[model samples]
Target chain A: DQQVKQNSPSLSVQEGRISILNCDYTNSMFDYFLWYKKYPAEGPTFLISISSIKDKNEDGRFTVFLNKSAKHLSLHIVPSQPGDSAVYFCAARAGNNDMRFGAGTRLTVKP
Target chain B: DTAVSQTPKYLVTQMGNDKSIKCEQNLGHDTMYWYKQDSKKFLKIMFSYNNKELIINETVPNRFSPKSPDKAHLNLHINSLELGDSAVYFCASSQGFGEVNYGYTFGSGTRLTVV
Candidate 1:
């Protein structure tokens, strides 16, 4: 069973607009959530993360909001640029060192 | 310098063949991990090692084994691979295991195909 899920397979947005990517998880034990950006033929790089204790975390133009009650989280990017176009993955981890990742959402930002 | 690096970026072999993927990290981190990304682009943790010792082993099959010769190296060996084993495997390293300060640095990943 998939513990974490990204319902959207792909998302497209115009430059300078806002882009939102959503993810959900079924495991209540997960207390840490992270977002990673990936390019083709490369490894996923960490973008942002939030501890369950915090509802939101922001870094520059990227913001991650966590809704503990809903077991959901979202990443928002304002003034999206072509460089922001990539596959985004949501990951969750419990007490153990293991992390579960959702199927990535391919984001395409048009000029 | 690459924080984490894996060898043989692409590997293709028969179902009954055996192969190994080598990984090394220059970050001097105490924790290392092996993760598999399937065709569906779902990433799953397979194993974790701390200071060359096995710390976490998920529900992976016995055919797959992870060896850490030292804190800087972790290698995966698959015996009698099957077609279903085809996937992209990534190696990552972190200073801490899962604490707030632990942020993973992943390798470029090795894409393995079993025909």
Candidate 2:
């Protein structure tokens, strides 16, 4: 069974707009969450992460919001650019480094 | 230079054949893992090794085996390959188990096709 889930398979937005990706988890044991960006035929690159202790974390134009009670998290990119188009994956880590990944969402930014 | 690398980017083999995918990391990470992405596009963890010791083994079949000669290397050997074995396998590494300060890094991936 998948502990982490990315319900939306794909999303599209115009450049200079906001792009938001949502993720949910069934397991409450997950304490660390991260987001990665992947290109075709390339490995997923680390984008940002948030610990369970915090509710929000921001880096540059990328921000991650976490809700422990809801078991949900979101990644937001402001003024999305065409170069930001890619497959974004949300991953979670449990106490022992047991990391689980979501199915991933394909984001397309139209310029 | 690549931090994590996997050999044989693509492989096509017949049924019942055996193949191996090799992975190496120059990042000096102590924990390494193997993840598979199937047709459903879900990234599933198969196995994890820390300091050459197997730490996690998921619901993967016995036909798939992971061998770690050293901390920097983790290899996957699949025997009696079936059509359902076709998927993209990724190798990843982190500093160590339970360390979340740095995100795990992954290799490009190896696409295995079974005929």
Leading candidate by DockQ = 2
> Comparing to the true complex, what docking class would candidate 2 get?
medium
In candidate 1, which residue ranges exceed 4 Å CA deviation?
B100-102
Tell me the TM-score of each prediction against the true structure: 0.97, 0.98
How many pairs collide in each candidate, listed in order?
Answer: 0, 0
Which runs of model 2 end up more than 4 angstroms from their true locations?
none
Give the TM-score of chain B in candidate 2. 0.98
Interface C-alpha root-mean-square deviation, candidates in order: 1.6, 1.1
True contacts kept of each: 0.64, 0.68
- Model 1: lDDT to the true structure: 0.93
lDDT of 2 by residue, A43-82 (tens): 8888999999999999999999999999999999998999
Model 2 lDDT per residue over B1-115, tens place: 9999998999999999999999999999999999999999998889999999999999999999999999999999999999999999999999986677468899999999999
